[model samples]
Target chain A: MSAQSAKHMIAKNIGVLGAGQLGRMLALAGYPLGNTFTFLDTTGNPSAGIGEVIVDPENQHLAAFLDKVDVVTYEFEHLPVELVKQIEQHKPVYPGSRAIAVCQNRVEEKTLFDRLGIPTPAYRVVESAEQLAAAAAELGCPVVAKSVTEGYDGKGQAVLKAPEQAQEAWDSIGHTQLIVEAFVDFVREVSMIAVRGRDGEVVFYPMAENQHVGGILRYSVAPLPDLDPSVQQTADSYIRALLDELDYVGVLALELFQTRDGSLLANEMAPRVHNSGHWTMDGAATSQFENHLRAVQGLPLGATNAIAPTCMVNVIGLEGDNAALLAIADTHLHRYDKAERPGRKLAHVNVVASSHAELLEKVRACQALIPDAPPVEWSFESTL
Target chain B: MSAQSAKHMIAKNIGVLGAGQLGRMLALAGYPLGNTFTFLDTTGNPSAGIGEVIVDPENQHLAAFLDKVDVVTYEFEHLPVELVKQIEQHKPVYPGSRAIAVCQNRVEEKTLFDRLGIPTPAYRVVESAEQLAAAAAELGCPVVAKSVTEGYDGKGQAVLKAPEQAQEAWDSIGHTQLIVEAFVDFVREVSMIAVRGRDGEVVFYPMAENQHVGGILRYSVAPLPDLDPSVQQTADSYIRALLDELDYVGVLALELFQTRDGSLLANEMAPRVHNSGHWTMDGAATSQFENHLRAVQGLPLGATNAIAPTCMVNVIGLEGDNAALLAIADTHLHRYDKAERPGRKLAHVNVVASSHAELLEKVRACQALIPDAPPVEWSFESTL
Candidate 1:
């Protein structure tokens, strides 16, 4: 398209709602494409420490900021709803506030899924201690208790292996509103990603199996061939239904559980680019970062095919020999410049290959070089 | 490696010989891996104008510039050997002065190749107008005449379809020093990329099929499967012989010709990262750019296995919308930041994929979205 054709949609700058690694990566990706990135953070956050960091949402001319750029997008779902609403007054904020609201609350997300005829773990809203006791009785003793709002990477969520741990989990959440879900007896945890444009066109990347540990993503592998076709379809349906209901207008991730019975259940939805989609950087035709940019910019989505069976391993907080890790062949490591602390999201590497097995071998090789990492576990939940 | 380990290497901040796109990219890639980049171009040639554009290489160094960094490497072959020798007293140079001496001139490179028993196109010395005439007659009517000391990208070279074009070619070259070679009827081009650390262990990447247009590199596809095993062996032998002959270090590109006789003939070599290796950025085990830095730093050479079947297309003098091209998925365009003009290397986009044919389709699609570029014809000399 010519500049004249793009003049209608071209905003002078983009106001990314959350200035974290995702936003920083988006900024990096967009900057070279000649797009200006204005970051939104709590002002003191490291993401804002480098780029055009904006803290205050009020008393600023939203019009001027919107006027300078095209549209607004966020890297994380934790952006304030009021700020999102305020930004909407001036320009479109996508995946819109509704998507954020639904994705932000596990209860609301499950309720939406249930209403949309999408399969989710048997879940119930827990209002208080008494409600949790009754809900767990119905759901099961080993059920998971999660705060209805604002939880990610295993925070504000706990497993009730026994009734003794329920109070601890409840007290840990400060008795906040929570959702009790029957733990899935799934064989594999996987995710499906899609980019939804304003015109309602959606492009889905090949499904990927995710492995998580300690509520943290440890690795993600694509074209999850072990996944049953029915499960894959069900996962795709759940994601599309959620996006359709929320009117999502960017890349969204649907975390799913492929049960032992071959049934796929919706676990959660992320409104923005999710960690599971990081493999797209080297594996798929479009990276989640670039696709999010294109989706929010109202551009045509590119091909959503995996060029290879890809594995993305998060370089969680380890100050290993940087040269050693980087010297690995065909391994692309992306450092977020985060301080290396135990369990911190420091950097990530995407390994691409012709097959999932080869990618796993690469992941193993690369992970071996990453010093101080937790021992490589072949767990289903933990993924990087 | 720590500062203590790096200390023994006599950390010399590299003074790149040329300030062009290669230098600019070399700087961008080198610095992040822990080396500082200083260029020789004055007033910052617009191509190398991306980051901390070093405008006066000499005065800038004494102005406490060299204090911050260690070691030096050249981006191109034609870096004045004398200037490099002058800088040698201050910082160590990789690929060394010997590499420059051998690669900068066609006569010298040919002599070295012949001495090493490498097969090349039939040729003879053409120093003067009379020499050009005699050489053409001996070689045949249709020949390629190139200045022995300076020629590249079809510049300083001409094709003689008949003897009449010889005098014009000589005049075009100013009849200073030239070599006329019998133009071989080759089918395609391929290149072998290898990196040698100070220890002399050569790590080679899978050979790539090179496709060129208008004498400028347009695309390179890796893992050229059609190559005969014997020819591939010969190519490796040829590179090994050249590196040994030059006592070379760092990443080097060996372009070859796949003649009708099914033999690989010597074309030329780039002592630094060549355009054919751009796919390595996202497609290789270790990028040529990073490996070059590693080799220059006296570090271990990396594995050269390709992660994907990748194709790279150069965006030359684009008149279309930058945002349009930038929005495309899987597109990595490296703009030199030079003022867009007719026939200048502006930017290049690498489309990485698993299937060779699929990557070509995307390249064509991207080429359509970007500005008009003349169809680059692939001769037997692009990668070969």
Candidate 2:
């Protein structure tokens, strides 16, 4: 769909912030639309090929890449805010600074959630050691003390046994900005993905339950099993309210905690399309990559129905022969062409089936196809 | 899936016979599969870089190109059998030359059908003007007289309104080998796609009612409405019977006519994937393209169930701008990447919906998006 942009920047390309797999996939999806998209990266990542990735632009040349594109979007955060601000001056950045600023820090995201009246766990922003102790006193022991900024994949999150552990939590996170959050009694960790168009339309995909191992996301299944419809409503409401408050554009992902009382608590938000939404590429009517591109271009949002109850399992680098994984039945293997490094996300396989049990069986069958994949121990319990 | 062979051809590369959109799409599909799939074009043609299209291989030095690849396959028939035989001495040609020879001509295919006790229209082989006259007398008026070999897209076949039109029919076809057949009073036309793996396993996609205009396919809808289960069974039997008889490998599309009384008659066959089966790309659990690749590679056939009752419409080049076609809502537009010359097969769009009416609505919406596209008229009787 063509975007109705003003003549001023209609000829401009798009500047993508991060050059990771999402950027590569986005660039691939955008390539069909022609030379409308380009990416500028701070890292010399290999997947950044749809367009040029400016590793480090000089002060004068910095605006050249941003100037070439009409708008800016990002694939990942962790880039300095000052770089984003510099580009924002020359072009518009969707899921703009406010969203990314909040997303960069747990404390800021929670405060933004609280102010927006979104359902989130009770928490306090901690500064000094006294403030950490005070916040813990208000909450309780066994709480989560996490670095407010730049923490991902269970990093910087520490469990406090008492006031003694609180100092270590901030210290473990490099003693940057920190948050002392009350631990919610949760039954499951789930995520919701939605795209907000430039026209202010918010479209949500089916809620999916995310399972992680070693702090890295292992798999995600859509239409979370035995889910209450209310969870969808709450998730949609929370996303819409938050997006509207930020006037967000492009895709957003919300990490949610389903509490014992069946209440959904907001954990954090991602400004760009998240890994949990990757199944939508094969399983949904429109992939998150395509939908995000559409939304940012001011085009119509695509249908978000799950392709089926699909389970997506990520392959963290192959320790042995890659041939076994390639042999998976009817398998659509998406291996990122990045250099193989241990613990690096190599590829993901989406197993689509009619039912959950069948999906599990398919996953196991696929796992068998990949030699030396970590054994999947499947079980469920109600902490409530 | 790896193809086990006397020589692992994919170990080097592979050459495709035709450089049309089918070859182009196949090339795109194979990009992630690790092997560089190239093309051998009768004429140099640009087809989305499936690989380099080598024309005039004899003059260009076939050894140089052939040395670069191992196995060979064609995207479509119309390739000369001698060339295929020549290629076979070096690399295997899928769908085999014997199968192509039988399927490419009407006389051989019809004789094969008759031998298998496969039901088809009454017919007689025609050699000359005298033979045409006699065959017309035998088959009666309003019969079809046509050349046997290398005729497609309703070319060469002519309706004989009277005994005198037989000569004109023969003249129009420039007859080499020909057939005259009684025309069946069928209400609609349908095509079934079946794939045969190297192991001789066969899997069939559901019957699709095809709508054509000017001898070109306009649209095809799957899960043919009100079709008897036995009819599908008959169609499958027709496919399997042919598959076994020819020792066919890769995809075969059979065009069938259902007489007013509900009897099935084999009209013609395509040795490779046909336009009528394009709906399988997004409509089926696995695409016909991917399945053909699998079948030819000795991999297990993918499940062929219709994921959603789907409708596919061909996007023929129109008088005006084709750029707007990219905006079609809920439409998957595949531009051939061919420089559009008016009336050429420019592209096709496949739309999937939960119901027939929704599909029609989506089609209309798509038509609106392609303002420059030729006017699309829907058949009210389209089965979905």
Candidate 3:
């Protein structure tokens, strides 16, 4: 090829389905590679701080947006599978529509995990009040009934503590397909961010121990200090299997539960960059957002080595105090340009240090700067 | 104050005089802090890939653009000082008009250096052919004659080797005001990037050794290897004096020459984020771009510690081979998304390593990937 065409070939225009913080970060990372982005979001103001946002809520103009870009990816998994499939016909949609379709529905996700021999909590599909009662009896008390789709951040889910509450749970969520899962007594919640390249190369970031309040992630510590090497191996193997099965090409976040016996059970998976991997932006040699863009663009994967111990605290629903946040030494603050609302993921703070103690100290100082910040549990033992 | 007012106060809209790579990187670094940028450039397409660009060549709508931003700064030193003065009336122009005016004129810049007791080469202003001959005779042969204004990257300058060449040099650039300086027989070129806060706190990044071809910088290695601490101290003191003299706020780069006797002489200074300090993007705890924004916004300065040894290679007027560039492990590639032209800076490669030897190896590998790249001289003996 002539040099001019070759140069033009290297420059790509990528389209994103959502303009949230993930898309914003993706643009931030991808722009350095000389890549341009066009975002399709319901809101014209996408968290992608800089990009042309096409507001097409009903996906009526997906083709118009698709025609302007060479490849397509989404910031969130909740985008309708059919929309992705339609875009795929015009241009390549990375991570594939099948992966999004499966991950968007709890039943399909769990079934795929089972098929791949990955361990997960026992679950039964519940279609009606009778099925809910039966599944509750089989799974025992305190079984969690989750909507198969359209559920996120503790939404569209309820716990049935007794048989008497089964009908109430069914009445609330039975309008959609559901899955009743046996509540495993997990000791710690952790997640691993893995990426698969177009050429089938797979890599995983170090595991991050997570703490959630009201089902919203509050903070995460990467590499999950003192983690059993075998658990990491198991998580890697399971994610590898999923990547190969879905023929995925982008960042995939696998959430898992560590039970009392030291065994791991799959919780769920995100088809895009995960909140837990946010620490990579400040702590790792390569951030998850950058890696996702690299993988989708078919570039070589970067080193995922952790540069230091890091803690990522989400600034959920609280606004202001930006000046105070900038005062903390060595703390990297990322504010998503989104309107603040209770329970909304507004921004995040990354505190990195040479030691775990120093990291915890800085994290505390950062929290103190924001008076309304949610409590960040510092469980040192998990990182011992 | 209520939290809402405090939050609104933190959100700042910054305007830049030139939308070049420096401004682009500044916008990139500042965006994560929730700061937005509006760039004013003659070119409709600016390197600031992600910000609102206002293309106003005649300055007729300057007030309209200034009305949209809270503060203003410039990317390059060549901008008209009068324009900056006009903007200062509407909003704060960082580094102020005095700094820009002095730095833009070689006569004023060298005068200030002498007044501050900083070591610099002996020179004479040449406004006529007779003055050029007299200055060359006084300074001896091989003197450099440079335009007092609008000179950069080897342009608007000529080196006169013999007395007979003075007439030709004068005839070539006699229309503009010029300064003729005795060229020092220097052993090395080094630079220091320093930042001063609004609160009067000062910090400096480690010195960087630079290599230039045709007066255009080709590469720079940070920390200057085994540079003498005293030399660093001297550079720091001189820069601090300049900062205090100008009441400077934001990043300033001081370029100096290291003679064989180890004495340092000031060459020039850039009153904004500089090319020599680009390695900070990957090597330093806080990049120079981010620190510039911090200083201008009155935010606390970040740590200036170098995380590792780093080398920055400028990609001047070259394109393609992006895949080959990304193939190198741990190499950070920054493409400015500009149309390629001879002598234009289209991109840069930052290679970081744990040790200087390893860094050299990676830098060599990076050079190999770009066939037309300028040679990078790795002087181990100087570093040692």
lDDT of 1 at A374: 51
Query: Candidate 1, residues A28-143: lDDT per residue as tens digits?
Result: 45543445677655544544333466664453655555665568888888767887897898788888888888888787788888899988888888888778877888877788
Q: How many backbone clashes does candidate 3 have?
A: 1
Instruction: Give the number of the best model, judged by lDDT.
Output: 3
Model 3 segments more than 4 A misplaced: A1-8, A43-45, A381-384, B1-4, B43-45, B381-384
lDDT, residue A137, candidate 3: 93
If you assessed candidate 2 against the hidden native complex, which CAPRI class would it receive? incorrect
What would the DockQ be for model 2?
A: 0.18
Which run of 10 residues does model 1 chain A get worst, by summed lDDT? Answer: A375-384
Q: List the candidate numbers ranked by DockQ, top first.
A: 3, 1, 2
Compared with the true structure, all predictions reach lDDT values of 0.72, 0.73, 0.85
The TM-score of predicted model 3 comes to 0.96
Ranking by TM-score: 3, 2, 1
- On residues B194-293, what C-alpha lDDT tens digit does candidate 2 reach at each position? 9998889898999998887778887788866578899999999988999998888889999988888777899989888789999987788777876777
Better of 1 and 3 by DockQ: 3
